[model samples]
Target: MSERVILTTSSHLEGYRVTEHIDVVSSECVFGMNILKDMFAGFRDFFGGRNKSSQAALRDARITCLDELRREAEEIGANAVIGIDLDYSEISGGGKSMLFLVATGTAVKVTKV
Candidate 1:
């Protein structure tokens, strides 16, 4: 996709009008936490400070999911996505943990107003 797909949390863009409502598009990303990260997170939990590693991982996952969303929109001939939403969750069990991120939006074709 040569042109960048516009993304907005709002249902409408200020300067653009939607010409076509394509479909809902979504992307999911999951990242595993290694033992070292778990250990550091435990230390942070005890010491009461920010967990930089976990923060970075979440940031990376968010970016990846958003990028994938954009790609999906483009693949289906959408020029923009509206009402974008991001969801994050953690899955932990048996001393193993993972971060999950989901990005969703409505793909559409838009024209400048």
Candidate 2:
């Protein structure tokens, strides 16, 4: 397919029919904040406010995960991914903060209805 892969959180796409079930694809990412970012985030945490650096890190992780998912789907000749599920966790310990994200979905070949 020449177009971008359709991604949906729902079980199915509205106007497309699944013609082939290629496989289930997943992408995982691990991210960490730098010392400066951590210091800033820690300061914000002390004040009980939103941490922009942490938020940006997570946003980047999610975007990277989705991009990887799309790449995998395309590699399998899939035009869409449905039933997408996202999992997020903080893997922090020993005075270090880290973020982990995983994205999973069913890769399928679809045709316009």
Candidate 3:
């Protein structure tokens, strides 16, 4: 199995030197909202409270996006990814609503300093 790729939002990783700049890698994940959950969330919104189900869906989307980003980095022979950026958006105005998450970073070969 491939090792877990190091990921950081910062420009650099402590104790690791970027030796080779591989390429930019990105991954995106989209999750459809459940109608039932939406109804519940709509009720909660009326009450001005947090919606647990929506939060959980957003959490899952982030995790999947990160995993995909790591796989992409590993495919490019990169052991680490730097300058990572994560974005989230909700797509509506259609029959269904969806959550989208995108992760991006620069893949690089790294060595311990």
lDDT of each: 0.96, 0.91, 0.92
Writing each residue's lDDT as its tens digit, candidate 1 over 1-113 gives 69999988899999998999999999999999998999999999999999999999999998899899999999999999999999999999998999999999999999999
Backbone Cα, N, C clashes tallied per candidate: 0, 0, 0
lDDT of 3 at 33: 97
* Rank list by TM-score: 1, 3, 2
Can you give the TM-score per candidate against the true fold?
A: 0.95, 0.91, 0.94
Report each candidate's C-alpha RMSD, comma-separated, in the order given. 0.9, 1.5, 1.0
Which regions of candidate 3 fall more than 4 Å away from where they truly are? none
- Candidate 3 structure quality by residue, lDDT tens digits, 18-88: 99999999999999997898899899989898999999998999989999999999998999999999999
The candidate maximizing TM-score is 1
- Candidate 1 residues lying further than 4 Å off, grouped into runs, are none
Candidate 2, pairs of clashing residues:
none
Kindly list the per-residue Cα lDDT of model 2 for residues 37-56, writing each as its tens digit. 88988899898989888889
Top candidate by lDDT = 1
Cα displacement (angstroms), candidate 1, residue 84, comes to 1.0
